[model samples]
Structures are given as structure tokens and as C-alpha cells.
Target chain A: MNYNWNWGVLFEEQYLNWLISGFGWTISVALSAWCIAIVIGSLVGVGKTVPNKIVRGICATYVEIFRNVPLLVQMFIWYFAVPEMLPEDWGRWMKRDLPNPEFVTAVVALGLYTASRIAEQVRAGIETVPPGLSAAATAHGLSTAQTYRYVLLPISFRIIVPPLTSEFLTVFKNSSLALTIGLLELTAQSQQIAEYTFQGFEAFTAATVIYVCIALVATILMQVLEKYTRIPGYVGKEA
Target chain B: MTDFDFNVIWSSLPFLWQGLQLSLLLTLLSIIGGIVLGTLLALARLSGIAPLAIVAATYVNLIRSVPLILVIFWFYFLVPLALGRPIGGFYSALIAFVLFEAAYYSEIMRAGIQSVKRGQVHAGQSTGLSYWQIQRYVVLPQAFRNMVPILVTQGIILFQDTSLVFVVSLRDFMTASSIVARTEGRLVEMYLFAALVYFVICFSGSMLVRSLKSRMAT
Candidate 1:
């Protein structure tokens, strides 16, 4: 209440550049991790629903193991423990020679951790598709993969657009955790600004606003996509 | 170096156990606080009052947009200045968790409330119930029942998130483990043990929630 307030310091060149690059890193990490999550999550999700008991069990176990662990702990494992677990030279390479090891580890950690949650959503979306569609596809002589590619996936992806958007936002938010591993992304940059300037309120408030803007834009874009991709006479109409 | 050590964990259990207690305490207090605040937020959003609805929606979206660690830092830094005195890390972290979790809990509660049929409210009103009475007697009971599983799931998330307090140097379970890991040079052992405890607790908690969900379905 008594302290001097200086919001204008954020506009000064030094901190502005830090925040800009920090925002860029946040987006890059989040978007790349999202790509990994969706790819791996869909495969695991399909595996979960497949008739092969062994494959299903493996997928289920993967989801369980990843989902049960905290993302922070998982990041530490990837950054610290996993590198040392490798052979001596490989460990050294990971610890030293790897390009932006913190960034890579963060992407892997956030991606794999989120993939479990995405897998669940993907599984739910796929299962929500009518069974008769798959049955009809098979009757028409289409293979299982073809059925998923043509019939089930098209509909389920449409149905799941809204949830996927939420997950997308989640990935963005979770990117802030990458700071823990020494990636100076948006949240970390904000903290650094606060540390140096003693303007914690201004720094975090700006970061919070940037985060909200990103989430809002993502939400709006996804809503538009959801509107267009919605299956007529189906899910989106009712709810 | 080749051998895994369980002895360090056993030796350090007392210190780690205290941290675990703190984690649980944070989770429990925040659960109660979050649910109460969240219910109000849910009702406010649903109340159709322009200002209240907008405020509730904005609060939920804003909090949900940022990483919770930032919120923890915000409160850690701001609360003391706002109050003209510094507070302890535990209290700061607890306040952050409560406010942050309330945003998520509000969204869940909103969905739960919306899931209750509109006719239920009409029925309550037809029976001479006041507005508050209708909500208390008719809407809330059903919404609470519907939301129990999700609330517990969020509670598990809150437990996991408590680890972020390591940034504030709070001696939560993860912090304690990291401390022991550093001092004792048993990095792998300490971290893995900490992870295992978290995994066991969260895994079992989710299983319980899954069963509760199925039971509700049936």
C-alpha cells in the first residue's frame, strides 16, 4: 500500500525483450509438446480400445504410470535421473552435448505426462461413436485401420474438439512448469523480472494477462472449428 | 552406486513424514476452502446477475489460464505487502492453493449444477420453497452428489500440485525429498521413493474415484 508503483518498467527494452522471447519459448514448448501428446495419445488411445488384450493392457499401464506421477517429479526424473541411468557416454552426452537439454527434457516430460490425460479423452471420444458405424465399415470390407481412419476417427475427433481445446490450454499452462528445469519461459522470465526489479505484481500481472490472451484466443479458435466440424444431427446441436 | 538404497528412505522417514503431513494438511484445508468458495462462484455465475456472472466467469478463466505456481508466487510476494506484514510460506501456499483450486472447482460445480434438470427447481418452487430453500434442498444436494467423484479427482490434483511449493522453499513432501536428496547424495533413491509414495497414494485415490463413478452410474 505504501510502496512506489512503476508499471512502465515493463516497457523498458531490457525486460521487454526478456518477456518477448520468454513468451516465444512458452509458445514453442507448448505447441511442440501438444504435437507429441496428440500423436502418442491417439495411438495409445486406439491401443486401449483394440481387441488385442496384450496391447490394451500395455496401453492401460502406460496411461496409469504416467498419469499417476506428478509432472514436476516426472520432469526431475527426465532431467536428472534418466540421463544418469543411461550408459556413461550416453549419460554424458545427454547431460552435456544435447541441444537445449532443458527444453528437450521439458518437452518430453510435459508431452508424455499430458499424453495420458489426452489418451483418456481420446478413448472416451472414440467409444462415444456408435458401434454400428464400425460394424458397417467392416461389413463393407474395410479393415480396422480403414474403419478408424474413415468412420470412427472423423466423428470422434469432431465430438472431442471442445475437450481437446481444454487440453490445449492445459498444455500452455503446464509449460510454465518448464521453468523448474531451467527453461526461462514466460513464467520464469516474469519471476526474473520481479527478482531484479522488485515489482512482482507488475511482472506476474503482465505474464498472467499474456497467458489469458493465449487461452482466450485458443478457446475462440477452437469454438469456431467446433462449430464448423460439428456433425449435423449429432452431439454439438444438443449441448 | 549399482545398488538401490531403501535404507536411506527408512532413515529419513521421520523428516519426510512430517512433510507428508503438511502436504495432506494443505490438501484438506484447500479442499474445504475451495469447495465453499467454488459453490458460491458456481451460484454466482448461474444467478444471471450481469456483474456477478461476469466476475465469476472472469475469475475462473483467468486463474485457469495461468500456471498455479505463478499464483503461488503471486500470493507469496503480494500478501505480505498487502497486509503490511510477512506471512509464513505454508500460509501463503495454502492461500494460493485455495484460490487457485476454487477456480477449477467452480467450473466443475457449475457443470454439476447445470446437469440437474430444470424441472427439479420448478418442482421445489411449486411446493412453496423459497429461492434459497430450493437451492439448498433441491439443487445443491443433487449437484453435490453428482460432483463428488470429480471433487475427489481434483483433490488428488491438489495433492500433486502441492509439490510446486518447493519453489517457495516450503517443506512439503517433494521439498523434503529434494532436501534429503541433496544433502545425502542419494538423488535417485530419494526422488524415486518420493515418486513412489505419490504414485501409490494418487493411484489408489483415482481407483477409489473410478469405483465411485461406476457406482454412481449404476
Candidate 2:
């Protein structure tokens, strides 16, 4: 109860700058990883529904492996273990020559982890599409690939917008874990601020507020996207 | 380019087992605590009292909006400061996980509760049961049954998240692996072993949930 309460240290130039840079890194990491997640996740998701057993099996295995492991452990494996497992020259380059190795590793780790979850969402979204529509597309002389590309994917992606929004928000939150691998993202910067000023409460409170704000803005934007993408006369699972 | 060293992992089994036990303990304690607190929050939100519902909603939303790691840091500082002395890492982590997971569990509980039919409540009321009795004897059993698979899914996530205690230097499974990796100079082997263990446990847990879901559907 007697601890000193100093809020001023948060606005000081160095700490403020740290927070800003940290925010930038968080956005950078989340966005870059999300790009990776959405692209690969959509492919794997669609692949899971393909007729080829081997492709479906590979996609399922990817989801199982990636989703099962913790992101922190995966990050560690990428940051510390994978490099050593690579060829000597490649490993040395990754260790010493690769720029922003921590950031890159964090992105790849988080992206792959998030992808598995997104894949599940995408699969569910696709499955939610009424079976008759896919049949109609096929019955209309559409090739299997064309059926998916034109009919299945468009509808599935729209249906999944809501879940994808949550996943997008999750990417930002999980970006905080990048701190474990020495990426100076928002959480790490706040921890740094706390360390330098001993104002842990103020520092973390700021980080919490920033995170809440990011989540709020992201939610609102995604809601708008959801509204825009709503298929007329279509009732989803909730309905 | 060292050959795969099963010997290092075999020799470190005791230490690793100790860490895995701690991780499981944390997961168990947090799930129990979170579900209990979360049920209260869910009930408060569904209670139809405006202020109570708003307060519960705000708490759940705020907690859900932030990352679990930040909450862990917040309590790691706040608990010691508030108590006038430090509680050790395990207790602090436990407190944080309970509070954070409560928010998630609240949402799941809310869905489960709502999934119980309105007709059942009316049936209980016609039988002269009080509100609490209706909830206790009628709605809750079905809600809990419906929620079992999802609750297990959340527990699996909790188990994976327990590894985040590594930030606090807690010797959870991941942290223990890293320590042995450092000491033995076998980072690749140690980390791969850790990942494999986590995969086995979590994969099996998810598979169980899938089976439970199918059974429930039937």
C-alpha cells in the first residue's frame, strides 16, 4: 500500500518512444503473421476437403501437429533449435547474418500456430455451406477445382468472417508471446519500461489499455466487414 | 550436427517429470478455479439485474480483450505489492491463470447455460421448484453435460498455456526443457523432446474431445 505511484515516467521521452516502437513491432508481427496464416490456412483448409486421401491426410497432420504444440515451445524451437538443425552455412546465416532473427522466428512460429486454428475455422465454414450448392456446381459441368474456386470458397470465406475476426484479434494477443524470444514488442517494451522505472503497474496498465484498444478497433472493423459481407437471405449457424 | 541423443533425454527424465507434474498441477488448479468463478460470472450476467449483468460483462470483455501474458505480468507485480510480501512464482501464476481463464470459461458457461431449453425451466416451475432448485436440479445437469467436451478443450489449451510461466522463470515443463538444453548443450534434442511430449498429451486430449463431441451428438 505504501509503494510509490509515479505515472509521469510513462510519458517521459525514452519510455514513450519504447512503447511506440513496441506498438509498431506488435502490429508488424501480428499483421505479417496473419498474412501467412490466412493464406496457408485457407489452402490447408480447402485441401482437407479435397478428394485425394494423401492431400487430406497431409493437411490434417499439419493441423494436428501445429495446433497441438504450444506457441512458446514452437517459438523456442524455431529460435534456438531449428537453426542448429539446418545446414552449417544456413544455420550460421540464420544465427548471425539474418536480420531481425527474433522477429522473423516469432512471426513464423505464431503464423504457423495460428494457421492450424484458422484452418479448422475455414474447414467448418466450408462444411457449413449447404451440400446442394456444391452438387449444383458439379452438376452444372464445373470441374472440381472450379467448383471449389468459384462456388465453395467464396461462400465459405464469407461465412468464416466472424471466426476469422476472432482469430485476427488472437494474433495480436499472441504477438505478446514474441517477447519470450527477445522480440521487443508491446509487452516486452512495457516490461522494459517497468524495469527502468520500477513502475510495473503503470507500465502494464498502459500495455493493457493499448491491447484493449487494439482489440476494440479490430473488432469494430471486423464487424463492419461482416456486415458488408453478409449474404442476403442467408441464416448462419446462430440463426 | 550431433546424432540424435536419446541418452540426454532419458537421463533427464526425473527433472523433466517434476516439471511436467507442476504444469499439470497448474492446469488442474486453474481449470477448477476458473470454472467455479466463471459459473458465478455467467450467472451474474444472466441474472437479469442490469448493474450485475453490466459489471460481469465488462469484466469478461476486458479480460478477454487483453493477452494472458500481460495479465500474468500484472498480477506478478500486483500480488506482491498488495500483500506486502511476495508470493512465490507458482502462486502468482496460479492467480493470474484463474482470473484470465475465468473470462473464457464464463463465455463457454454462458453458452452452455443458454443451450438448456426454456421449456425445462417452465417444467421445473410447474413442479413447484424454486428458482435455485430449478437451476440446481434441472438446468445445471444438462448444461454441465453439454459443456463437458468444450470444457475439456479449454483444459487442453490451459495445459499448453501453462508453459508461459517460463517468462517468470518457473520450472514448468518448457522451462525445465530449456534449462536442461542449456546445461547439456543439447538445445535441439531437448526442445524437440519437449514439443513431442506436449503434442502427445494435447493431441490425445483433443482426440478425446472429438470423441466426446461425437458421442454427445449421438
Put down candidate 1 lDDT per residue, A14-106, tens digits, no spaces: 999999999999999999999899999999988999889999999999999898888999988888788767777898899889999989999
Clashing pairs in 2: none
Residue A60 of model 2 has an lDDT of: 97
Each predicted complex: what DockQ?
Answer: 0.70, 0.87
Sliding window of 10 residues with minimal summed lDDT for model 2 chain B: B1-10
In angstroms, how far off is A170's CA in candidate 2? 0.4
Per-residue alpha-carbon lDDT of candidate 2 for residues B47-90, written as tens digits (9 for 90 to 100): 99999999999999999989888998899989999999998999
- The i-RMS of every model, in angstroms, reads 1.3, 0.8
User: How many clashes (backbone N, Cα, C below 3 Å) per candidate?
Assistant: 0, 0
Off by over 4 Å in 2: A236-238
lDDT to native, each model: 0.91, 0.94
- lDDT (tens digit, per residue) of candidate 1 on B1-218: 23567799999999999999999999999999999999999999999899999999989888998999889889998889889998788888889999999999999999999999999999999999998999899999999999999999999999999999988889999999999988987878887888899999999999999999999999
Best by TM-score: 2
- Estimate the TM-score of every prediction: 0.97, 0.98
